[model samples]
Target: MWIVFDLCVEGADGCEGLAIDSTLDHPDAMWVYSQGNWTHSTFATGDPFVYVQLQEYGNVVEEIDSDSLVVRFGFVKNMPTVINSDLEISFGLPENDVVSLKIYDIQGRVIRQILKNKTLNAGYHSFSWSLFDASGEHVPSGIYFIELKALRSGQREVKKLLVVR
Candidate 1:
């Protein structure tokens, strides 16, 4: 499950894989045991900023030697789906990647490009979008679809937002 995020780091020069040893400056010791493509580890405290090497492919196809990858366990939650003002789209990333947020009409046509190819890091992040379309004019009150796509892995999650004027 953890590997699904790609775990691409920002800048840890010459990193090959996960590690924790006496040489590391981190006080809270950490360890990750891997079997082929899957890994198992534990996090007791503090923000985890570790880098590892990966050969990205498929939706996350990027050839690399070492990437500064730091990740934290996270999820996305939107509040007040039934909205009168702006709608909040809140999500937490496990690593650095391009994220997209869009709204589509009932007919499945994109009405607004709230966010396009925005880069973000791990931990929680949120943005508020009022009920409007690309034209900047307010959209009519009805049911709309909010789409969140992680560009790196091509992973997607959707939610329905109801706007009431």
Candidate 2:
């Protein structure tokens, strides 16, 4: 599996930076960071836009087995949800699996727990974020993250959300 991450100013000219990683480099920090949680200091000053791409390549043997599980996860239509609004999130699974989804701030703190170890059916599934934290309070405009994980398959994906008031 290869993942690419891009962070830059929205409606701006160039990308601030880019990071690419592969499964072969396991146990090491990839794209985002090497150790601690990602903070605002690591990003550009303006409203940041985040984009991620996941690709999987397999040999003949793996390819045959890969048919059993195809993972297609991301925002609906590859767009971020604006702040103070309901954000639609979607993903596809080839088989039923236990999954968890959460929202985290730039400091890697869990602000909201959308789903936790819940079973989902095979097919396209989606949920909406109300732009509120676990406490039901409105979230401040800033950068936050949406993370989804397939517990059984150990598959994890992350996307950034820029909350503007």
Residue pairs with colliding backbones in model 1 are 8-69, 9-68, 9-69, 10-68, 10-69, 11-68
lDDT at 44, model 2: 23
Residue-by-residue lDDT tens digits, candidate 1, 1-102: 143334444353424354432223454455542222334345545555655454432135565644455443333563676888977778767777788988
Q: In candidate 2, how many clashes are counted?
A: 0
lDDT of each: 0.67, 0.67
Candidate 2 local Cα displacement, residue 158, angstroms: 0.2
Q: Top model by TM-score, which number?
A: 2
What is the TM-score (0 to 1) of candidate 1?
0.53
lDDT of 2: 0.67
